[model samples]
Target: MLNALLFDLDGTLTDTDALHLLALQQLLQEEEGRVFSEAEFTTHVSGQANANMCRYLFPERSLVHHEAFAERKEQRFRQLSPQLQPMPGLLRLLDFAQEHGIAVCVVTNAPRANAEHMLRVLGLSQRFACVLVAEELPRAKPDPLPYLSGLECLGARADEALAFEDSVPGLTAAVGAGICTFGLSTSQPPQTLLDAGAHRVIEDFNDPQLWAEIHRRLDVR
Candidate 1:
């Protein structure tokens, strides 16, 4: 049975990846006169945890510096996010889960502030039963601790839950946690997501393929 729904906040619920990239780009340009191309972002940056991302982008920087830079990037992204909206069919999917008595939660690698800001911007602050942030846990995505913790909070088994993710780390983490994971191609390439262990990839929640799978899993009419 489909007992829980796990969602990765940024790109899975909404197309906020571009804004995140823009925030990082603006900060990098201001600090180092560098431009971050999309290919570089998709390959080397997207879905990474704040500490890892900052270290990768500024390897010479100290942990304190990385933390500060992450804060700045998140603040800029929030400022750029007032126009955010839910992904197409997302509300409908949430409704389905609600109707079926399926528990819903958000598990993200984003910092707590960023996650809260984004969810509030999308009017979803009160939606999830649990919101798990990587920084609050012992380990972040690509390690499964976050997702495993999410399952614990929901009192759901990994095989009985479904996860929606838009990036490699998110997908890898959920799959590693033993949840059946579906990839939302909101930011990364579908094939890359599949390669990262996504059961299937879709452009958005509205994809017919996603609905078919959900129906097959839940055995609902």
Candidate 2:
């Protein structure tokens, strides 16, 4: 039985990718005189941890510089948080999960502050049973540690949980931890998520196909 649902906070639950992209674009232009296209952002930044993103974007910068840059970028994102919106049908899905007595958890590679900010803006901070941040774990996405920790916190087994992700790294992390994973085609193409090991893909929670799969997975009467 599917006892719990684990969701990625940014792209999966809310359409924060565009905001993040905008924040990065502004940060790069102001600090490094650099420009990034959406495609470039998808390839280099989306789904990546802050340290990894810093290493990729500023190979010559020290760890301290990277930390400062990341903080500034995240601050920009928070400033743009007023534009954030929950993914279509997300509220309905959350209601369904609650009505069914299914636990909900958020597992993200984002910093705790960013995650909390997003959740608060979306009015979801109180809905989740647990929130797992990659920064708090020894390892983050693509390592399975964050998702594993989320499952453990919820007292859930991988086979009894469903994980929703929007990026290759998040998909890999959830699938690697043995959960049945669904990909949300928000930041990445469905094919990319499939190649990364998603069992299924949907544009958002509103997709009837996603509901069909959820019903089957939970064996709902």
Candidate 3:
């Protein structure tokens, strides 16, 4: 039986990917006069570590500068947190999970402060049983530690848990942890998610019966 769920925070729970991209673009433009398109940003920086993402965008800058840039981006993101909204059916699914004795945890590559801000702004800080942030681990998504730690916190084995993710790195981490994962196509293409090891993919959480289907699927085997 599916006893727990690990979820990616940004695009999966809230539509904050665009805001994050915008913040990065603004920071780059203001600091270095560099313009980063959404496509390029998502392709190279999204789901990557803060330092790695900074290096990819500012290869000429030093590690210290990269950290400074990341800090500014985070500041901008927090400023935009008020605009955050939960994805359709996300809260319903969370409520259903809680009501049915399924543990729900947030396992994301986002920094703890930013994740907390988003959750608080969306009035969902208490919805999850745990919020495992990237800062809590030495490595982030695509490393499997975040997802594994989330399952550990829930006292659930990988085989007994499911993960919901919308990015390749998040999906990869969850799948690599030996947990079944479903990809939501909010940030990237569904095909790319499946290619990244997601067992299933869906466009969004707009369907009313989606939770029923998810429950049924997770309950089997």
TM-score of each: 0.97, 0.97, 0.93
lDDT per residue as tens, model 1, 76-191: 99889877899999999999888889999999999999888888888888989999999899999989999999999999999999999999999989999999999998888788
> Between the candidate structures 2 and 3, which one is better when assessed by lDDT?
2
What ranges in model 3 sit over 4 Å off? 206-213, 217-221
Q: RMSD of candidate 3 to the true fold?
A: 2.2
Model 1: lDDT to the true structure: 0.90
CA lDDT, every model vs. true structure:
0.90, 0.91, 0.83
- Residue-wise lDDT of candidate 3 within 105-207, one digit each (tens)? 9998888888889899889988888899876798888888888889899999998888889888888889989998888888888789879997778765665
RMSD (Å) of each candidate, 1 decimal: 0.9, 1.1, 2.2
Error of 3 at 89 (Å): 0.5
TM-score result, candidate 1:
0.97
Q: Put the candidates in TM-score order, highest first.
A: 1, 2, 3
| True lDDT of residue 198, candidate 2 | 94
